[model samples]
Target: MIDAQTLEAPTENPTIRTSRRWSPGACVWCGGTESVEEYRNEPRCATCRHHESVIEEARRFMGMYGLRPIGGTLQSDDDEEYEHRLGARDSRRVLNEIRLEHQPDPELVRKALRPRAAAVVAEGKPAAKRPSTASSATGSSRTASASAKTAAPVKTGTVDIDEIQTRALALLDQLTAIDAQLSLVADQSGLAARARRSDLEKQKATVLRTLAALEKARLSAASK
Candidate 1:
């Protein structure tokens, strides 16, 4: 008969030990617990993993075409906010394919993709303050001052006319692709196709506006 202690003894199972050792409690990248998966012996949430994969793919695509990945909100789709935006993934994929197919000059690509955050911020209005009867005059003057500040011309020292022209041409190419996608979805009655059409239309409009702005800016820079 086996003793009670022997019967109660815990067996050292290698498989169980290995599983316990590798099990992840939280995501290694974002520290979130939802949908965590083991990746290369490390735990990562699905979102972070997807982001990593997209970034890796972008880098590989850029490298293959001899283009450097410019780091900025305008150039990179890797931002958290962009990742959450509708059709951002599709835009990145489309952009990558276009870049690979065209293989635009590396210098042109770099110059064309410089950060435009200052201009973007300058174009936006500041938040409104609460109304105050006691300081109406003071508030009016302050508002005027703020308006003046925001209305100040965005510096164009970093902007090159050639770069703007190149960027505009690239955007036109992207717009054509987006239009093609929109055309494909135009006849489809499925909900998914409608959704895709909406995204493509929005992207097309955005690109057209951007191209127009780039043209204006290019003309302005050339004049200067």
Candidate 2:
């Protein structure tokens, strides 16, 4: 009969390492059979790799629907299988872009689109100049040149501190409410044990408040 100890010994977890031996064949994912080789090259079987792909797709779908980039990783929504609506951040970017039509005077963009506009206002003048002529002598010439320099655009791209503070305060309120909800939910039996709603909510409020204070100070000096 097989030894009791041998039978009771645990099978290894693929994600955890406990061996130094090498397998005779290559791993399908990274072509490594040896444990060291697998460790260095991140080898895996086709099934495991496919499972990873599924998880990534799930993450992307969640992110596209405004799930706040998950906890730490910015999910790249490249999977065609899991198409979802734009998140709040993406929606804000689109809205900002739309507002540009109302105030389209960004200096860099205007300069890029109208390369010929950068030419000296007098460039079209004849090669030969009269002895007494000053470049700014004419009224029309001065007006055109001045307008080119000063009137290209006057679009504001400033970040308003007061508005930012307001947003932060709003987020703080949200966090507080979430925290209270979490505390209510944390004590529930079964699956609710793993929930960290209250902790996350409290963390959210703290981080926003700290950032708001720092930004307020920074903008105060900048505005000066």
Candidate 3:
């Protein structure tokens, strides 16, 4: 017989879980007996709901920043592994921001990052990719120069709402990553860290408003 203490027990309201059989087990963390629930791949009781919320928020925060769980910690999807390497202290704070227990002092990452510019075109799916120029070097250069001068500028009014929203979402993801880094380096000692945090805060506010407006516009258009 498996010891109930070793196995995760079911919540008081057994209906909450639909995956497996219900058993009477205690929460590994708080030893609460009321309604233990599963959290962060572990069995948590109702007493740990606050902890569960913190982790849920962290995951959402990570998703906004183009990060995914690599092992037990957060990591970027970039080819270079070092770019988004978060320390243990920083990792814990990220996992739970409310209490901020064991928060690390702010330190700038060696591989600094800047948001990239995303180009969004107006209406009709971005014109299909054109074949590369095959003419002589001099002729090809001259042709490209001529085309550049002749091409009409894309107007703001002509910009596609859906396309702009998509671009904004991508930009928001990058900004979210920057925000996360800023949080790690906030309020410690250096002027650079302070300045970076200030700039990121401003950028975060602007991006959030833009996202909200875009969402409203999308809904309005759909209704019409």
Pairs of residues clashing in candidate 1 = none
Please identify which of the two predictions, 2 or 3, would achieve the higher lDDT against the true structure: 3
lDDT of 2 by residue, 1-224 (tens): 32232222233432222232223233322222223122112233343233334443444434322233322344443433223222323332322221111121223223332443334334664433321123212211234334321122111112334545665577667767766777777677665454565466556666565555546544653565
TM-score of each: 0.33, 0.26, 0.28
lDDT of 3: 0.40
After superposing candidate 2, which stretches have Cα over 4 Å from the reference? 1-157, 196-223
TM-score of 1: 0.33
Q: RMSD for each model, in Å, please? A: 22.6, 25.8, 24.1
Enumerate residue pairs that collide in model 2.
none
Regions of candidate 3 where Cα sits further than 4 Å from its true position = 1-161
In what order do the candidates fall by lDDT, top score first?
Answer: 1, 3, 2
**Clashes per candidate (backbone, < 3 Å):** 0, 0, 2
lDDT of 1 by residue, 11-32 (tens): 3433432232112354432334
Best candidate according to lDDT: 1
